[model samples]
Target chain A: MSQDTLFDKVWDLHKVSSLPGGSDQIFIGLHLIHEVTSPQAFGALKDKNLKVKFPERTVATVDHIVPTDNQSRPFKDNLAEQMIETLEKNCLEHKIRFFNIGSGNQGIVHVVAPELGLTQPGMSIACGDSHTSTHGAFGSIAFGIGTSQVRDVLATQTIAMNKLKVRQIWCDNKLSNGVYAKDLVLHIISKLGVKAGVGFAYEFSGPAIDELSMEERMTICNMSIEGGARCGYINPDEKTFSYIKNKLCAPKNEHWDKALTWWKSLKSNENSIYDDVIKLDASKVEPTVTWGITPGQSISINQQIPLLDDLAPNDKLVAKEAYEYMSFKPGQLIKDTPIDVCFIGSCTNGRISDLRVAAKVLKDKKVSKNVKAFVVPGSEKVATEAKQEGIDQIFKDSGFQWREPGCSMCLAMNSDKLIGNQVSASSSNRNFKGRQGSPSGRTLLMSPAMVAAAAINGKVSDVREFIN
Target chain B: MRSKFTPPIGKISNINGQCISLIGNDIDTDRIIPARFLKCVNFDSLGEYVFEDDRKTLKGKHPFDLEENKNSSILVVNSNFGCGSSREHAPQALIRWGIKAILGESFADIFYSNCIAIGIPCFTLPKNSIEEIQKYCHNQFLFLEIDLKKSLAKSKYLNFNLEIKESSRKMFLSGEWDATATLLANTSLVEKKFKELPYIQFCNDN
Candidate 1:
């Protein structure tokens, strides 16, 4: 248990009560809902004849199943059409704000919330989507919950939660040119295996973390779920305040100073106690990629997959599983491995900043004929912003498709899928077997810029090669 | 084929049922129930698809596919189980498959909360204690008694005190587990906070 970390402070502030069993009935400050996981929750509500308690706190949007190309009503897929229609109806019935498609406000739940300034410091955010932790970039305690708990929040606005132990993941100075926040997070997950953060909230702090832009911080916090932490957060600073100011729903001029004062005070004190602390040199991190089914089973872009003899006894079994499932030989460099698709989207890497990086690299290069690459912005705002900057045209000129924003190919929920046994270089989180739609399809998780490189080469190549 | 098992719902504390063991550690939620199955209506029928792929690869030899383990309600095994994805469908699939209690070395935070939310109590115990219990469960003859109120699990000369958070145990035993009723009754407290937060805006009420 942590004594004075930022997590402890936010948790203490939201605690409605310390229940008899040592758990706290913590009030959720924001409850974000999307099409996929929320239908059953609303169904559960209807079954109980319950109305949403504080419709003010709950927000709805369509994602997961919305078609990136054709998002018009009565979608091409019936199941998806029904899911979106149901969510729209539920939002209407429950009086929660819904950011519908083409609403300009619509996008991935994680991406839109922050841009609208709905996500902020010292608040507790819960969403049905696992990437809810992305909001933690704003210094809020955001984590994912299930549909039932989603229903719990919709009906009551609080959840019975046991506080998590806090771990300060101290990152030292600036990242090298080619390595972005995505690579840093992947390196962190690879160093600390996916299961290491199970009972903890990771407090990402230090010069390296503090220096990242708001979008970069979000990319790091977004994958915190992949690392198995309940949530990962960086304390709010000037960058955090500046990013939220002038946003659509941000605090007006009258409340600006008051909000900033509260946000600043929520940071962990210098003497704050933590359960454990780990250190890493961000400068040492290189472009990284997952070689196996799990996010933790990754190696640097130029590195080789470990041989069975090279792995710890406990890891050899999963290595064998990955080898057999992915049909790859050990001791071979991850670079130069052939890829069938290059996907640049999802809550992880679909932000405009990621697009700007990829587009810069792809400006004069033609995509390899053997590779099918596309970019899906995290939301409409990202798409609009990227287009305004002519980043979309750079990608389009390079033979990549510029689709509407949604979680396309991030999961198999929609039509954007990797066909049978097709290997993908993806910027999204998760490389789970069958995660990209095909039962035997393979997904190699990498940075968007790396995906841009793979799109040009038709194989996993170092992003640094394109940089210089 | 969808099995004809309508698992009991709510206010569950003590479980008296046979135990079944799975072979591996860190069985992820994706393995518990694949992402494709996540598209359906309520998770009631998710049981039929639970480990559907793993069971297919195991060629009907997986523990869940074994005829003798058909009616078993206690899942006994392993460390860091249910350690991926926040989809509560994993437990919903387990509960729908008739699993009432999970005895393991440890559980993932979100999965454990999902279980407790729906009255599925996940019991944590020492590793050796779990290994000892697995032997009995693997034999498919152990009819264990899990008493949540007392925090103990026992079956014929194999008795061990289980570790569950006191609040969780209280929730299960006293039927305060749902939390919907409790939260619904406290709207004023939530409304007050909503108004106090300067950044918050209330969308119109129906």
Candidate 2:
């Protein structure tokens, strides 16, 4: 028999039952929920008079609708207040845990789960949001489920799911100076095209991956959904074990040892055959930014958009659509597009490390008067770490608002929205039309340092200028 | 609560013989329906918002743009449809668009579940099968038969079995909401657990 791939081994271990429709009923080790999508599912539960089968297995938080500023009782927006109240009532009624605003644990769902150590290795995690792939950085199979499935998980610990084929993306070569994991993943996604990872779970492996800190790996996996992959993960290594060893949820002492052994077994066998294999060179990667509406419509800072006539027929239509929606000239250099706001937080790039990098660029420099810049750390822990290191002060001194931790304006579910068609140099993942709030608002996705650079210049200037 | 509930009660119909095909990879929720339209609580008017940017050009010619197709409700899209962004509004908007069913190569994980929950028959045919349907839809009315009785859907050129949770399928097919259906699945267990938790303990525990 052939050596089983990590995916095969994990699937075999977690398989609960085969449903009649040929989908497996995989057992989930953890389920994370939030205010936005859980209310309906809880309502369903209320109607059914069903209690959460395992309340301890589910964790909840409020990130979507919490105002980044002035999080007082009775939010100004009635809908936000209603959502918070509903979640509170539901969690209380079901006896599930919820981390509300100002709770030291409250933050972006993905950020809070890992920082508090609730997310663990070799455990399958699910949430009502797509970025649930963020947990896969710890060598877990995580999924973004729907509200109905939320009810399913709350009703029963296991969810019905079809097995996914594993695609091993092997990366070799050391990253050059100034090249970060964000750049590495962007290079990979651009190379693979947006749709390449559909129907597959991506297993990131390589010396470069092994060398990344756990936080960096989380950043890479955080945007896996952007590449059309349900989840992208790296097999847990010594770094993974070290990160989880002191986490609140990880096993203690001898149990830790047993857990580590099982986590180690989760890596693919040396000769494991993958449904697909994609190799990337780390040294060739560069800091990337999106020039068009889609994540895959990206290029290095120095490249220009392809002329409409040069693109393939289907691509041309998309390019034409992007050009019109973005209100950009056909061949304009992406480097020259002006930006109005600079956002440096989201599950995608909002971490202590991302803040530290942005602070490095903003040190002793002020944001251009023409641009409004701000930084929102991903979690309370991240905010505390940044403040401890004086990064918050650095951001404040540089004219950026150092706001409280939450999802912030990542998707503009709260008060942080663009006023009009003002373009934004953002660190968050998606650049879709009006994704940052206003119907006509535009977003240009880039790295934190790059956004900081744009904030300082009020345009799509290169970060290399301020690297020193 | 009954063991089997019916799917939602909208008039059900298969696709007409004629249709236009839009093929692309990784069509995200944002593209399906932009986030700006999500401010509304009700989904009844969102059909006009589907593919807003794409429909801007074909203002009059796009099938979705036409007044007659406003309730036409069957969406024919490409593989990996509804990828990115887990906004439930994506499906809600499609449902309000009068779309009774969707024929596609595959759907994103969350979108697929949302469609099933709301009684939208998400027909997943093989890539070649979708291609064949696209060809048949070009010249004739591509009529598909949606039979919730057997949990199978078919068209002249394609046939597919919808895969949904046993209970969820019943809710949709019977036009009943999931609240009552869920309560009945674990009625005994819920009542027993509620009985175990003392009502007065919550005020004293804190």
State interface RMSD in Å for all models: 3.1, 7.3
Give all candidates' CA lDDT scores: 0.86, 0.75
Candidate 2 is scored at a TM of: 0.86
Candidate 2, residues A12-46, lDDT tens digits: the string is: 66665554445666666779998877877787677
| lDDT (Cα) of model 1 | 0.86
lDDT of 1 by residue, A303-421 (tens): 99989998876567677889988998999899999999999999999999999999989999999999999999999999999989999999999999999989989886788999988
Pairs of residues clashing in candidate 1: A21-B167
Q: Pick the candidate with the highest DockQ.
A: 1
Q: Give the fraction of true interface contacts kept by model 2.
A: 0.24
Worst 10 residues of 2 chain A by lDDT: A14-23
Off by over 4 Å in 2: A1-3, A309-314, B1-26, B36-65, B124-206
* B53-156: candidate 1 lDDT, tens digit per residue: 67877799998998888888989868778877788888989988888889888887789889888778899899888888787666548888988878888888
DockQ of each: 0.46, 0.22
